[model samples]
Target: MEPTILQGYELAKQLYAKHGIDVDQALRQLEKIKISVHCWQGDDVKGFLFRDQELTGGISVTGNYPGAARTPQELRMDLEEAFRLIPGKHKVNLHAIYADTQEKPDLDELEPRHFEPWVAWAREQGLGLDFNPTCFSHEKSKDGFTLSHPDPDIRKFWIEHCKASRRISAYFGEQLGQTCVTNVWVPDGYKDVPVDRMSPRIRLKESLDEVFAEPLNPAHHLDAVESKLFGIGSEAYVVGSHEFYMGYGLQNNKLICLDAGHFHPTETISNKLSSLALFAEGLLLHVSRPMRWDSDHVVVMDDELLDIGRELVRGGLLEKTHIGLDFFDASINRVAAWVIGTRNTLKALLRAFLEPVDELKKAELDGDYTARLALTEEFKAYPFGAVWDYYCASQGVPVRETWLEQVRTYEREVLSKREQAAAPAQL
Candidate 1:
């Protein structure tokens, strides 16, 4: 370890000791917490499937950065590079479309063998895997409705796809010795005002019930449902709205996914954590940054991210909450985006863990609002950067801006290769 890191850590330890905060203990706890890095970041949401079309769901990925992963091996290489830069032990979240199979199986026909390579890669890396059903960019979903589609055949197809996704998730857990979180999110809604709003939601409910009909051991797999407010074509109404999923999650004993950008712009998910944790056994968070709507921009160390970490730490819901990234940016180096986002998330969590939670709670319980507010503001000035640097050093990752140079070097050697190969024949 560097002398600067050791000196800075010792000074930070003494400062935090005054507030009854154990800096070393906080570092240990932060190391134990893992943020599931999204695999889509390496490929700009373009899965490994043989589809030649644009994004269909209400989402879009802007920018044309070079070297987007074109194969499972390439994507995994990019992910390995990203993980190398990010500190701490972490997991990777995979979409159903990323299956490494030669046969072009439709979503309904997807099986665990299709994703066997992913499980094998994850096992080799000692990573826990999470799964998501690809509910968009398909012929059936081009109409902007899936589970809630009035067409029984289309709805049935999506339901079967969801069921297949769950089975694959369970297989991942069985193979990797870790529970896989399988989240179902559908882009089912109307573009214009519909007279029969209630009917679509009812159909959606029925479809979900059918998909989850098969019972899987909770020890191996966990199920979650995600809801959205609106999308590009479905601005009028989204059948699987937050309220519907909240109700269903509570009733079905499933994890409710609260996407940061899925709700109204001003609505923050931090406030919903305590309230939902009260009713649900666990929660899954799709942590993303939305420029205007659910844009799925890369996450940063912003106040909203900090608040999320604070809420989880204050409420002691770290173990109960599943933290996963849900953003993609192709404008910059994709691997760099992954490293930046994941590192920032870990930084926010470290900040939360370093907080003197007991002191804050004591002040609140004693009705000392003045002291509580003061302590909150004062703690912000602590040497958090020092502790963060120490943590990175301990984790064998590049400290501070040193990681940026590594990314630049990798871009020169690796990401630039694709651009060179695709360049037009000069003169």
Candidate 2:
């Protein structure tokens, strides 16, 4: 783990407590600190999202937490740290765990054995749940990307999983005591479909509504929709928009999770900013980035951070944003290495926020997207640790030390399992 990030977290504690209770005031100060600490990761421009101050920043840890969690109790704590340490204003993001998502059982664990423990851990640690079940396996979504599939059994199977997860989702709200479903990303859309396509979202909505509608809602859980800026029939939205295949989901009032990274390669930065602004203004949940139009989820730095944050704040979505630090392990940071994965992304976002709006606007207007466009030079500054003094001097926020400690204990437990899973079982 980066010592600087820890120091920043510690400072967050000091500043937050300094403010007594007012969450709004404390949040603004922390935003400034976020800008400073986040920028440390890089020398040039294009800092991190977690590192950014302008956005509703949050922190997240990855892979290691899973392996560290051999037992439910241990797992709960790591997540707790994520919740407590990251702070409410900032959302703690989790990868639905591509590996875990794919870890399907034939008959033994018909239901996720870890389901109860996972939820329990989340509540104990004071963290909300965010996930993308499809990354793991479509066994549950066998009906073909949500409700579109024609198989009732497949739909039933996935619905069952949803029901089980609903229990956990409820815990996040009632027990863990969170608000939104934190980023229920369903990458359930088809790519190879022929001719015209219908709303895959409508199908997904009916399916989730069917499950959440059970008297279990209100008490048990709520569902959120993810609007990915993907494509249709091998062409862009202008040509064949990937989101067109999944845009129907956003229309649902349930909830919306906007992905910053997906805007890349597919659309322009402005388009993505507008979508998030509309979503945030409407009080929708926001997911953090690594989007490069067509690129996969990587660390948030470079131009992506600035583009996303500017739109978010300018759009007035920051106040209502339910930020999730979404990440997918890459060659640089694979799954399970929770510490680096989570911290790196957090630092990036934080840095993005720290950027002065005037300068950013000037750059945007002038189209001086040099740093905004390139990733390498933009992030060339930091060696390993990158905390700046000027950034801190201007930052101030209140921290709930007790709550922070509570979540830290949980993160340790969660990361414990991640440690255990470092090596894979023989097939």
Candidate 3:
């Protein structure tokens, strides 16, 4: 053990003890909180369909950062590099489009064999997996809507795609010894006002009913429906708005996915967790940094994130919440983006665990508002960084910004070579 880390943790332990908080127990609990890292960041949402398809459905990935993973092996290698720098065991989140196969099965025809490589990779990496049904960036989805399209053929196609995704998710849980979450989010809305709004929603409900007709064991899989307020093209109305999913999830005994970026800019997801917990069996959080719109930026240790962490811990909802990151920044190094976003997420959760929740709750309940506010303010300045650094060191990962050096070395040795080989000759 490094003398500095040991000395820092020892002092931090005593500091936390004065507030009746156990630093050691907090560290242990933090280790059990796994943040699922998304795979789209490795390739700017360009999956291995081996097609020249542009992203549709109001979704887009900006910037052209060199070295985006172009193959399955490269994406896996990049993810491996990222996991090494982040502390604690985590899960890999996959999309239906990332399947590794030459057959290029349509979304409706996708089978478990399409994702066997991902399952094998997860096994080798000692990681679990989560999945999403890809309903965008394809020919069938180019009409600006799916699942609620006016045409029954298009809606049925997307329904079949979601059904296949559920089976694949169950397979992941069975093979990896963890409950895999399958989230369904379709871009079905309009850019302008429609005469009738109820028809689209009715169609969406029917489509979702068909997708969830065959139930899978809850022990092996969890079904979640995500909603969005609006997107790039669907500015006028989003069919699967939060209100729609909230009612649907509670009625169907399914998890509701609360994406941080899917709401208005002034809204925060942290405030919604407690309310959703009351009726839903569990909640799935799509943690992302939204800039004005539903722009998915890398997550940072900001106030909103801390509030989210605090809510989970205070309400005892960690066990009932599936924490996953959803962001993709192509302007910078994608691997580093993964490391930064994931580590920050873990850090926020750790800070939540370190809080003197019992003490604060008692004060609030006893009408001692002054003490509650004071303690809350004071806890913010606690020696959280010392504990975070110690946790990282104990996990055999780099402490503090030391991980950046490793990322730089990887870029020079691996990423740069790929870019150089692919660059066009200069005139």
Least lDDT summed over 10 consecutive residues: which range in candidate 1?
Answer: 418-427
Question: What tens digits encode model 1's per-residue C-alpha lDDT throughout 1-427?
Answer: 9999999999999999998888889998998887888898888777867347687888788899888887888788889888888888788899988999887899899999998888889999989999999999888999888888899999999999999999999999899888899999998888899899899999999999999999998888999999899888888899999999999999999999999989888888999999999999799999998778768888999999999999999998988899999998889989888888888898899899888889999999999999899999998888999999999998899999899898888888888896777522211
Q: Provide TM-scores for the models.
A: 0.97, 0.55, 0.98
In model 3, the Cα lDDT at residue 36 comes to 90
Model 3 lDDT per residue over 1-427, tens place: 6999989999999999998999999998999988899999999998887336998877878998878887888889999999999998999999998988878588889988888998999999999999999999989898788999999988888999999999999999999998999999998889998788999999999999999999898888999999999998899999999999999999999999999989999899999999999989899999999998779889999999999999999999999999999998999999999999999999999999999999999999999999999999998999999999899999999999999999999998888778877533211
Clashes in model 3: which pairs? none
Tens-place lDDT digits, model 2, residues 1-427: 3465556655544443442323234335435322101111111111111112221111122222133332223333333333223422332333222112234443212333334444554455444554333322234433224444446666565565556555545545565555425234444544454453544444555666665555544433445555555433222322113354234335554444455555545444434546544543233323344434333344444565545544655454555444444443323212222333344444444444443444445667888887455532443342212232222222321122233344455445543345546434312
Stretches of candidate 2 off by over 4 Å are 1-114, 131-146, 180-184, 187-193, 199-205, 212-222, 229-251, 263-271, 274-276, 279-295, 333-427
Global lDDT of each candidate:
0.89, 0.39, 0.92
Comparing 2 and 3 by lDDT, which wins?
3
Q: After superposition, how far is residue 299 of candidate 2 from its true place, in Å?
A: 1.4
| Cα distance off (Å), candidate 3, residue 326 | 0.5
Off by over 4 Å in 3: 422-427
| Candidate order, TM-score descending | 3, 1, 2
